[model samples]
Target: MWKKPLKPVTKKAVKTKLILLYEDIVCDGTEGCKRHKLVGKKYFGGLYEGSERNEDLWLEVQQYIYDNYDTEYLKNVYIAGDGAPWSVAGCRVLEKSKFVLDKYHLGKYIYKATTHLDDSQQAAKEFIYGAINERDFDGVMRLLQKCYASTDQEYKKKEVTECARYIKNNWLGIMVRIDDGGAVWGCSAEGHISHVLSARESSRPMGWSKKGVDWISHLRVLTRNEQKIIDLMEYQDKKQRKKNRIECEDQLIQDVQKRKSSRNEEVLRKAIPGLEKKQFSWMRSIINAGGIIA
Candidate 1:
C-alpha cells in the first residue's frame, strides 16, 4: 500500500490518497520459487473524504483479510512495504504478520549511501546486499561505515549515516527477508500504486477536488475488482431511484388526494437521464473522474 499524493485543485489545497492492496501468492516454498499473479482486493481513500480515522482504516484492513482468508490456518503472512508507519502498521493489525522491508526502498537507501563511490558504487551495493542476504547486521553496518569514511564530502557522510539509521530501524524487517529465504518475493507495492492510483489520479497534468479524488479512487478499485463501469452507474441509478421513491411516497399520496398532478410522480416514471444525455456537464464530470473519458 502507498500514500499517493494528488494534484490539488487550488494552490492552498493539500490532498492525499491512500490505497490499500493485498494479494495472495502461492509459492512452492522451495529454494527455486515459482509463483503466479492472483486477483487482489483494493481499498482507496482520501485524507478528509470520509469520517474514518487512521485506526479505523487499519481495522478495516484486518477485516478484509479475515473475510478473504482463513486466518487461523495461515502460518505466515508477510507485509512488505517501504517502512512507512502506515505500511508497517499492518503487522500490528494482522495475526502472524511479519514486516519485510521492500527491496525498492532498501535499494534506494543503499544507492544513496554509495552515491559518493562513483565507479565502485555497484560493487559496494553487491557487498551490502550480500551482507543482508547472510543476515549479518554488523557486516552491513561495517560496509556503510566504509562508504562513509571513503567520502570526505559532509553531504555524502550524512547520506551514509541516514542509510545506516534507516537500516538499523528496519533491521527486523530485513532479517525477515533473510530468514524467509526464497519463500517471500520482494514487495511490488510501488508498481501496484502506480498502476492502481497514480496512473489515473496524479500521472497527468490536471487538478482534482477532494470529492473527485474520493470518487475516482473508489471507481478505480471497483474496476480492478472486475466491476464494469457501466454496471456501476446502473447500480447507482437504481439506488438513487429507490431513495427518491421512498422520499416522494408521502407527498405523492397527498397530491393524489388533492387531485393534483405531481412532478415527483413524473420524475419517478422516468429513468435517470444522466447516462443518456452526453451533453450534461455533471455526467461528463462523473465519466471523466479517472481521466479516461475522451
Candidate 2:
C-alpha cells in the first residue's frame, strides 16, 4: 500500500508509508513420475508443476486486509508479478492499486514481440526496449502503436495488439513510478517468495501442507524484520529471567518458535495495548527493499 496525502502535511507531521502485498505458489517440483528421454536414455521423473492459485490467494488476502484494516495510508500502491493469471487477477481486483509489469516478465514479452521484426521493425524494437528501460511508458506505447499500424503479418499484428492492451491497462500504475521519482522495474515479491518459500520447498522435498507452508511463511516474514527479531529476543530474555535465570533448552526452543510464528501486530497489540505507538519501524525498510532511496 502507498498513499499520497490529500493535502500537504504540516512541518510538524510528515510520514511516508508503503505496504507490500505478497503471495506464493504452492507447488512441489515433482508430482507423480512420467517418462523422459535424455541422451536417448529413457527414464522416469516426476512431472514438475506450479500452482495457479497463488495469485488468487494473494488477491483474497489483499481484499481481506483492505476490508479489515485502515488503508488510507496507501497513496500509490503497486501490485507486481510475473505473467501469471493470478498476478493479473490480483491487479484486476485491486484496480486502484498500481499494476506494474515485472521487468523480467516484460523482457520475455519484448523478446516474443520482436521475434519476426524486419530491419525497420528491428529499429522499432530497439526503440521500444530503450523506452521501456528508461521507464518512458508513453514512448513505448507510441512505438508499439506505430509498429502495430505498419506490421502486415496477422500474427505479428495480433501480438502487438495484445501487448498494447497490457501496456494500456497497466499504463497509469507504471507511469506513477516515474512521476513519484521511485524505482519501479523490479519485483521484491519474487525475491521474498523465492527466499522464504522456495528455499523451504527445496529443502523439504516432501512438500508442505497448506497450513505448514502458511505458518513457515509467516514465521519467515517475522524473522526477516529486524525489529521483530529484537522484540523476540527481548521477550525470550524476559521469559528466561522470570524462570529463575535457568535456561531450559527445550522450553526455550519452543518459546522462540512460538515467537517467530506469532503475528507482529498481534504481539505488539498484546504487549502494549492502546499504546498508540508503532513498534515495527523496520516495515518501511522492507517496503524499500529493492528501491532507490532518492
Candidate 3:
C-alpha cells in the first residue's frame, strides 16, 4: 500500500487526502541471475479523502494485495514503513515477514538529533549505518547518550531522547542483518512517495474531489507501466464502445417516447407571442440555411 502523506490545498486547508498507490515488482529468482533483473511491476492507487477508518485501512491493504500481488510467489516478505503506529500495523497482518524500520525514517530522526552537532553529523550517520552495530542497539543508545551529554540545549536533548526511544522500540527492525545471518532488511517508501506520489499529487495548489483525485492517482500509476500501455488503451476503447452502445439505446428509448411532430416542430414558434408570418419565415429560413439573416 503506497499511502502518501495528506496534503492541504486551497479548497480546504484543514482537509487532507491520501493516495494509496498499488505497487509490486518481480525479480529474477534464478540462482545465477547475477542481478535481480526486474521482470514486471503493477502500479496503481486510489485517493482516499479524509482519514480512513481503522478497519477500512487494513481492509484496503488486503484488497491491494489480492488485486496486485500473487500470494503464491510471495516468499521473502520484507515489510517497511516509517515509525508510525499505523505503519506497524501493516507488518502484523503479514505472517513470517521481517519489519524493517525504514532507513529513511531512521536517518531522519538521526539527523534531528545530530543537526545541532553540525560537522559531527557525518560521524553520527556513520555510527548508525555501520555494520559493527548490527545487533548492538545498546551501542546505538550509548551514542545517543554521548550526544545528549555533549548538548546543554534542551531542544537538542529532546531530539536525542526521541531518537533514543525510537531506536529502542524498533531495535528489532534496526538491524541490517538480524542476528548477522546475512539476510538484509529493506524499504523504499520515502523515495517512492517523494518521487512518485508527492511529485504529482501534492506539489501543486490544486484541490480535488473524491472522484477527481482518484482518477488522477490511477492515471499517474498507469503512466509508469509502459509495458501495459497497449493493454490499457485497448481496455479504454472497449469502455468507449460500451458507452456509445448504451447512449444509443438511451436515445432510442427517448425517441420511442416522443412523437415525430414534437421533434420536427420549430422551438422558436413558442418564443414569440405575435410574430408576423414574414418574420417566422425569415427566422426558419436562417435556421435551415444555418446562416445569419440580419
Candidate 4:
C-alpha cells in the first residue's frame, strides 16, 4: 500500500510493502486437516526498497531458513502468492520450491468472473475450478470467453476478460494444488498482512515516511518474534556509552559541576527544607559509587 511521505509535499507517497514467510506441515486431510494445525514457524520480512531490495529480502530469507530450519530433511517448499512476478521469482532463490496461487485471490477472481451468471454462478465456479484442477488453461479461457460473450454489460465483459487473464497467467500456481495432491492448503497472506503490518501501518488514517514504515516493520517483526524493544535499546545505549566512555564521563562531570554552580540551587534549597542540610549528598554518593556510569 502507498503511504504519504513526511517531507517534500509535492512528491508522491511511496509504496510500502511487507513480505512474510513461514513453514507449514499440512496433513493432507488424514490427520484432521484443520486450519490452525497447518501453520508452523512464521517470520516476518522487512520492506523492500532499493533497486536490489527483492534480492536482498530473498537472501535474508534463505539465510534465516538455513540458520533456523533443518534444510537437509526438507524435500519441497511451497511459495504461495497472488501471482505477482516478485512472488513467483522466489522459487528461483530457494531450491525445490513450487509456486501456488493464493486461494484468496483466486476466489476473488472467480467471484468476479461468475457473479454475472446469476443462476449459473455456482455451476460456473465448479466448472472453472475443475478446469484449473485439470490444468486446462485453454478450457478455462473458453469458459471465460463464453461468459464474456453471454454478458451484454460492458463491465461484465471486462470482469470476465480480467479473470481469464489472471487465470492464464497464474495457471501453474492454480494447478499446483492438484499437482501436490491437495497438500498446498492455500496462503494466508492477506490475514498475515492485516494482522501484522496493517494493524500499525495502514489501519489508521495517518501517513508514514518510507524510513518510518521500514523502522516500524522491523519493530513489529521483533515484537512478533518476542524480542523486547526496551532490551534492544538498552543494549545499544550501553554499547554506545562504552564506545565513548571518556567523553561521557567528561560530559557528566561538566553537567554536575554546572548544576552545582547554578543560581537555581539556592531556590531549590529554599523549596525543600532539608536541601542545604543534605548538601546534595545523594549526588556525591552516586559519583563515588560509580552509579552514574550506566
Candidate 5:
C-alpha cells in the first residue's frame, strides 16, 4: 500500500478591508489605455447634498477620461447615471459628456408594469425592450401610456402612468447610444453600490459619519490602483513608529530629570556637612521642650 500525503491547511484571522467595484472599459492605442482597463473613483453621500462634492468627483472622472482616452473620445463622453437630478446636473458640467439614463432603473419600471398587468405580461416585457433598443423613446412612452389608458383600475393606472413619465422625462438620457454618438456599454452602478460600497459600509447594523464614510471609500479606491495601498499602509506605519519614538524619548527625558534631581539632593547633602544633624538637633530640642506644633 502506498502512503498518502496530507495537504496543509492554513488558518487566517478575518480582517476588514474596503471593497471597490469598477467598470472595465476597453481602451485603445495609448499608454494609459493598454487594454480592458478598470476605471473607478470612490465617493460617499449623494451628489445633490452638500457643497462642491459633485464638482470634485467630476474633476477626477474627467481627468481619468482625458488621460486614457483620445480627444474625440472626450467629445463623445457617455455619462451613465440613474434618474437622480444630481446625476443630470453632474453630466451638464462636462461640456461634451452626454447623459444617459441607466437602463437598470428603467428595467425596474418594466418589472413594475408586469406585476400590475392582468394579462399579456410577457408581451409587455418584450415590447418595452424592443422599443428602448430601437431608440424609440416616444414609442416606449406611448406604450406605457397605452398601458395606463387601457387600465380602468385606478391603482394600475397610477403605476403605469408614473412608468411612462419616467421614460418621458429622461427621453434624451434613455437612448444615448442611438440618439447621441456615445459608447455602447452597460452601466454597472447597481453592482458597484450594492456589492462594492454597501457590502463594506452600509450592509451591516452600523452607521458612519460623513467624513468616516468618505475616508473608507477613498481607501477602497486607492487599493484598486495597485501598490498604492501598500504605500499608504507603510506611510501610516512610519507615523506610528515616529509617535512611539517621540513618546520613548519623552519618557527617557523625564526619567533622566528625576535621576538628576535625586543625585543633586545627595550631592547637596554631602556638600553641606551636619545638615541632617542640625535638622535632627532642632527637632529634638523642640520635642525635649514639649512644645506643641502650634
Candidate 6:
C-alpha cells in the first residue's frame, strides 16, 4: 500500500507543488479476447466519455485533497498517467502540477522499437531498458538515435522519432522517478487501473457510456481508499447532529441530499458567490464544512 517517496532532482525551475498520478481504461467483459472485442459483449457503463470519466475523477480527487489539506501539503506535484488523452488532460489541467509519463507506456514504445530486432540484439534492448530505468534522458535519446541510424530501413525512423518526442516532452517526469531513487515510480496508478478494469473488460461488451464506467471506477477507488469513506461518514454524522439541533427531519434529509449531490466547486461557487474571493478559498471552506462527506 505504501511506496517510497521520489527524491527531488536538481532543476533550476521550482518543482511542481503537488503530484497526482492516475490511469484509466474502458472495460468490456470478456475472458481472454485478443482485442477489446467480444461476441455479444455488453459495455460496462459510466459518465461523459470513458476518457472524460478519468479526467473528472482526477479533478474530483484533486478538489477533495485541496479542500481538506493544507496548500503547502505538496511543494511540487507530479501527475503520472498512461498515454491516454484523458490522463494527459488531467495532468495538464492541474494549475501547479507536472505531468509525468507512465514508465509502462514507455516500455511499450521500447518493445515496439525492438519488435523486429534479432535475438542477438537482446543486448541492445537491455541497453535501452537500462537507459530508461536509470532515467538517463540523454542516454535514452542517444541509444534510440543510434538504433534508428544504424538500421538498414528495417525500422521506420518516424516511429522512432515519435517515441523520442514523447520521451523528450516528458523527460523531466521520467527522470523524476530515476532521480528520486525510484521512489516515485508510476506503477501504482497503472496497477490500479489494470486491477480495477481488466477483469470487467475481459467479460463485458464494448461501447459502454462514459458515466457507467466512471461510477464503477469511482466505486473501485472508494473501496481501495476505505479510510476516505470512513472520514466522510464521520464528518457527515457530526454535521447531521448539528443540523438536527436546529432543523426538522424533512429539511435535514433534503440538506443531506443536497450536500451529497452538489459538493463540487462550481456548484458551491454558484450557491455562495462571495466565497469565490481567492482561487478556490470558498471551495476549500465548503469542502472543509463537510460538503464532501455528505
Q: Give one clash count per candidate, in the order shown.
A: 0, 7, 1, 0, 0, 29
lDDT for model 5: 0.61
State each model's C-alpha RMSD to the native. Answer: 15.4, 23.1, 12.2, 14.1, 14.6, 18.2
Off by over 4 Å in 5: 1-48, 67-75, 133-138, 150-155, 180-182, 227-294
lDDT of 4: 0.72
Better of 1 and 3 by TM-score: 1
lDDT of 5 by residue, 113-184 (tens): 666566787788899889988987778877787777676788787778778878788878776755664445
The TM-scores, one per candidate, come to 0.67, 0.39, 0.57, 0.71, 0.58, 0.49
Q: Flag regions of model 1 displaced more than 4 Å.
A: 7-36, 39-52, 181-183, 229-294
Q: For residues 96-191, could you state the per-residue lDDT of candidate 6 as single tens digits?
A: 565566777777777666555668467877998798787677898898887688657644676677778877776766766666643364344434
Better candidate number, 3 or 4, judged by lDDT: 4
lDDT of 6 at 234: 89
Per-residue lDDT over 106-190 for candidate 3, one digit per residue giving the tens place of the 0 to 100 score: 7788889888888888987788667326666667778888889988999899999998888887877666335534235345465
Roughly what TM-score does model 4 have, to 2 decimal places?
0.71
The residue-by-residue lDDT of candidate 4 on 1-294, one tens digit each, is 112222334555554445556565555555565645335555555667654786676677778778877899987777777887766777788767888888888899989988988999999999988888777888888888888988899999899888988988888777777788644675667676777777887677777777787888778877877789998799889989887998889899999977765545555446756643467787545544444435
Mind giving the per-residue lDDT tens digits that candidate 1 earns over 23-102? Answer: 65556456676754544656655453333455566676678778888888878767777787766776777678788888
**Local distance difference test scores for all models:** 0.74, 0.52, 0.62, 0.72, 0.61, 0.55
Q: In model 2, how large is the Cα lDDT of residue 108?
A: 57
Error of 3 at 150 (Å): 1.4
User: What is the lDDT for 133 in model 6?
Assistant: 82
Candidate 6, run of 10 with poorest lDDT? 37-46
Top candidate on lDDT is: 1
Candidate 4 colliding pairs: none
Better of 3 and 6 by TM-score: 3
